[model samples]
Target chain A: EAGVAQSPRYKIIEKRQSVAFWCNPISGHATLYWYQQILGQGPKLLIQFQNNGVVDDSQLPKDRFSAERLKGVDSTLKIQPAKLEDSAVYLCASSSQGMTEAFFGQGTRLTVV
Target chain B: DQQVKQNSPSLSVQEGRISILNCDYTNSMFDYFLWYKKYPAEGPTFLISISSIKDKNEDGRFTVFLNKSAKHLSLHIVPSQPGDSAVYFCAAIWSNDYKLSFGAGTTVTVRA
Candidate 1:
């Protein structure tokens, strides 16, 4: 079975610039999540979607970050006016409904200078 | 606030020895706990998990123990191998929202 897929494994941008990351979840998965892992820290939940509808996004930076899952299969996370602290590995994961464990992608490493 | 915490930043053990990593959580609502392993430049992979209903769950050489009263959980790896060298993270989720909360992580190294 294919695991979650994410494009642009690495990205470099300047502070105040905008950047976007994309992810394709496993087939038939109904739940998708985006997480951010800063250096020496664990992945922190940024947002979650349940079939095109947002389930949770309390930790998301409303002013600078946004994400959407179109048609409930693929997702895109965007950050505008990126800051130096925003530099981190953005990971995408997915799981079937009612399942506890999730499958994760290799992740996109973003570097904001 | 960070709910789950792995206080030990790093641990080193001899090959074939035992490795124990600890985690503590602040949220009582969190009923499910999980462990994930990550290599440099790679995303975390699910390792093992334990539910609130049970005190212990074992998977092959890996075992997880949960103490509800203390809100603490631990992972034990017996006969650790060199391949087990990586950063280990502890995560928690409350059934209500299913949002995962994670700790900073504990780096483990196994020497040959």
Candidate 2:
């Protein structure tokens, strides 16, 4: 079976610029998630979507970050006016309902200069 | 506040020896705990998990032990191999929520 897929394995943007990342979840998966992994840190959940409806987004920066999952299959995460601190790897994961384990994508490493 | 913490930033052990990584959580509501292993430039892969109702879970060479009363958990890898060197992260989730909260990862190095 194919795993979760993400595009633009690497991205570099200047401060104040905007960047977007995309994710395609595994087939038949009902839950999708976006996570950020800063250097030397574990992945932190930025948002979660349960079938195109957001389940949680408490950690996302509302002023600069936004995400959407259309049709519950693909999702996108955007950051506007990117800051140096925004440099990190953006990971996407998916899991089936009532499943405890999640499958992750390779992630897009974003570098904000 | 950080709900999960891996106090050890790095650990080294000889090949064929046991490697133990520790993690602690501050939230009692967390009922499911997991361990993920990650290599450089790759996403974390789920290793093992234990529920609050159980104290230990074992899978092949990997084992996870949970101390619910102390809010602590640990992962043990026996007969560690060179390929086992990677960053290990501990994560937890509340029973009602599917989202996971992760700790800072611990880098493990196995020497031959």
Candidate 3:
């Protein structure tokens, strides 16, 4: 079985510039998630989608970050006016069900200059 | 508030020894706990998991022990191999929620 897939394993952008990361989860998986992992810290949940509907996004910074999973198969996360503090690895994961083990993709490491 | 905590940032053990990593969580609502191993430049992969009702669960050389009363859990790797040297993260989730709360990982190095 194939694992979760993400694009542009690495990215760099200047401060205040906009950047976007894409993710394609495992086939047949209904639950998708986005997380941010800063250096020396664990992955922090940014948002969660259950079949194209948001399950939770309380931690998401609406002022700068946004994500969507349309059609429930693929998702995208975007950050506008990126800040230096936003430099981190953005991970995408999917699970067969809400309570199952999640499989993660090789994250997109964003470096804001 | 940090819901999950992994106190040890790093650990080094000689090959063939046992490597123990600890984690504590403040949320009692979490019913499912999991361990994930990650290599540099790679995303974390699920290693093992245990439910709240079970005190222990084992898979191959990896074992997960849960102490509900203490809100503590641990992962044990026996006969640690160089390949086992990596960052290990502990995560938890409530049955009703799809989101997972993760602990700052513990990096384990097995010296040959």
Candidate 4:
């Protein structure tokens, strides 16, 4: 079985520019999550989706960040007017329904200058 | 207001020694705890976990102990090997939701 897959392993953008990252989760996994990991810090949950429906997004910056899991298999996370603080690794993970363990993808490293 | 914290930024241990990593959380509602290991430029991989109801969970050489009353947890790796060197993160999930809150990771170096 394949693990979660993500595109554009690294990205560099200027402040005020927009950036997007894509994720394809493991087959049969119903729970998908996006997380932001800053240098020297642990990953922080940005949003979570369960079968195309958002389960939680309390930490997401509504004004600048948005994500969608259309069709419930692949997902995309976007950030507009990126700030310096937004430079971090964006990780995508998936888990089986009601499962505690999450399988993660190689993250997209975004650098906003 | 960081809900989870890993006070030690790094630890160094000789190969065959024990490596203990600590974590503490402020949210009492968190019932599920997990540990993840990550190498440079890679996403974190699930390591071991312990639920709130259990005081300890062991898997091979990895053991996790949870202290619900103190809202603290620790991971112990016995007979550490050079291959075990990596950044370890402690994460918690609230009982009401699946969202995971994580602490700053601790980098462990098991030197030969």
Candidate 5:
């Protein structure tokens, strides 16, 4: 079975510029998640979607970051006015159910200069 | 506040030796625990998991042990291989919530 897929394995953007990352989860998985991993740290949950409906996004930065899972299959995460602190690897993962083990994608490494 | 903690940032062990990585969590509500392995430039992959009801779970050469009373859990790799050298993260989830809280991650180097 194919694993989760993401686009633009690497991205470089200037501070204050806008950037977007895409994710396509595994087939038949209903739960999707977005996470940010800064250097030397573990992935921090940014948002979660269960079939196009948000399950949790308490950690998301509403002032600069937003994400959506249209039709519940593919999802996109966007950051506007990016800052140097936003430089990190954005990882996408999916699971068959909310409580099950998740499979992850290669991730999009965003470098904000 | 960082709820999950992996105090050891890195560890080095010889191949064929046992590698033990430790994690501690402060949240009492966390009922499920998991371990994930990540390679450079790659996302973390699930390695093993244990539920609150159980103390241990094993898969191949990897074993996860949970000590609920101590709010600590550990991942043990026996006869470590060079391929096993990577960052390992420990995560915990509440019983009613699917959101996982993760540790800072521990990098393990299996020297040949």
Candidate 6:
């Protein structure tokens, strides 16, 4: 079975610029998630979508970050006015409904200079 | 606040020795625990997991032990292999929620 897929394995943007990351979840998976992993830290939940509707986004920094899962199969995470602190790996994960374990993608390494 | 904690930033062990990584969580609401392994430039992959109803779960050469009262969990890799050298993260989920809370992670280096 194919795993979750993400685009632009690496990205570099200047501070205050806008950047977007894309993700395509495993086929038939209904739950999708976006996470941020800073250096030396675990992946922190940014947002979760269960069939195109948000399940949780309490940890998301709404002021600068936004994400959407259109049609519940693919997702996009965007950051506007990116700051140096936004430099990190953006990971996309997905799991089938009623499952606890999630499958991950290679992730996009974003560096905001 | 960081609810889940993996105090040991790194561990090194002989190739044939056992490797134990520890994790603790302050949230009593967490009911399910999991371990994920990650290589450089790759996203984390699920390794093993344990539910609150059980104290231990084993898969192949990997084992997960959970101590509910202590709110602590551990992962054991038997006869560690060179390929086992990677960052291991502990994650938890609470009742009625699917969002996972993760620990900082432990980097294990298995030496040949």
lDDT, model 6, position B5: 99
Q: lDDT winner between 1 and 6, please give it.
A: 6
Off by over 4 Å in 4: none
Candidate 4 on A1-113: residue-level lDDT in tens? 99999999999999999999999999999999999999988898999999999999989999999999999999999999899999999999999887878889999999999
Instruction: List ranges where model 3 is wrong by over 4 Å.
Output: none
Clashes of 5: 0
DockQ head-to-head 2 vs 4, winner: 2
Provide DockQ values for all models, in the order shown.
0.76, 0.81, 0.84, 0.76, 0.75, 0.79
Global lDDT of each model? Answer: 0.94, 0.95, 0.95, 0.94, 0.94, 0.95
TM-score of each: 0.98, 0.98, 0.99, 0.96, 0.97, 0.98
Q: Tell me the TM-score of chain B in each candidate.
A: 0.99, 0.98, 0.99, 0.98, 0.98, 0.98
lDDT of 6 by residue, B25-92 (tens): 99988889999999998999999999999999999999999999999999999989999999999999
lDDT of 3 by residue, A13-104 (tens): 99999999999999999999999999999999999999999999999999999999989999999999899999999999999885558999
Candidate 2 lDDT, A1-113, residue by residue in tens: 99999998999999999999999999999999999999988888999999999999999999999999999899999999899999999999999988878989999999999
* Model 3, C-alpha of A52: deviation from truth (Å): 0.7
- Model 6 Cα lDDT, one tens digit per residue, A45-110: 999999999999999999999999999999999999899999999999998887888899999999
RMSD of 5: 0.9
Q: Show pairs that collide, candidate 2.
A: none
Candidate closest to the true structure, highest DockQ: 3
Question: Judged by DockQ relative to the true structure, which candidate is superior, 1 or 2?
Answer: 2
Q: RMSD in Å for candidate 6, one decimal?
A: 0.8
Across residues B13-38, which tens digit of lDDT does each residue of candidate 4 receive? 99999999999999998889999999
Q: Per-residue error at A86 for model 4, in Å?
A: 1.2
